[model samples]
Target: MNKEYINIALADDDEDDRFFFTEAFEDLKIKNRVSTFKDGIELMEFLEKASLLPDLLFLDLNMPKKSGIECLKEIKASSKFKEMIIAIYSTSSSEEDVENTFVLGANIYIKKPNDFEKLKKVLSEVVTTNWQYETSGLNKENFLLRL
Candidate 1:
């Protein structure tokens, strides 16, 4: 981890979403290093070998190969990734998805905002959130971070 900035990682297949995600962090001016991956497979591969894991991870549920749900299961199953804070960043707000990811140990869930400004606001809020409190004891109510 960089001593000067928070290390944030995002895994999303959509090119446009990836662009907007990085842009939101840049505009927040919070001194964060944001790295993005195109798919869960790629993200998992990096995590397996990375010396310093990101302080937080934003994962999208749907993807062409190795869906986020699969990735979450894989991540949660391994002891090495136990402390990683994972947020379910996806367009889907399905109840099943929410409940499933919550059970799988996602730190939070966020529905993608259609407006860029809303997205920025949510991202900023998440970046500033005290994750230790939220992750210490998972609460169903706080599991989904509403914007």
Candidate 2:
């Protein structure tokens, strides 16, 4: 699983958001494979039996069918996905949402940016970051609460 290219997945219902996400990755010119799921159920189904899981998974909180919180809880409870980095990518930046996801074992929380350039920057930073090392250095005071 130590491949050169990073495996990235995004689950968001908005078509424009998904387009921007893919476009950002392409514009960055990074060596990575990106996958998009419209809802939580689709994402869960893909990951449940997939041989190789994405190194990073970006989840949008508000969606039809199942919410990100539900997906996050399910993913965190499973030992098989302990290595996967879960980043909460949502429009809402509520403190409650932030605290809940953090407590639920999300690796990071990124508030969706309105500006396209900012989105690109955020995506780039998240993709380049060595999350394993970051998590090892994670403290209650300096948790991955926001970006």
Say which candidate scores most in TM-score: 1
lDDT of each: 0.91, 0.90
What lDDT does candidate 1 reach at residue 50?
A: 98
Which residue window of length 10 is worst by lDDT in model 1? 129-138
Cα lDDT tens digits, model 2, 1-147, are: 368899999999999999999999999978999999999999999999899899999999998999999999999999999999988999987889988988898888888998999999999988888887898875545544444
lDDT of 1 by residue, 34-143 (tens): 99999999999999999989888999999978999999999999999887889899998999999999988888999999999999999988878877776677789988
Separately for all candidates shown, the number of backbone clashes (residues 3 or more apart, or on different chains) is 0, 0
Give the runs in model 1 whose Cα sits over 4 Å from its true position.
Answer: none
In terms of lDDT, the poorest run of 10 residues in model 2 is 138-147
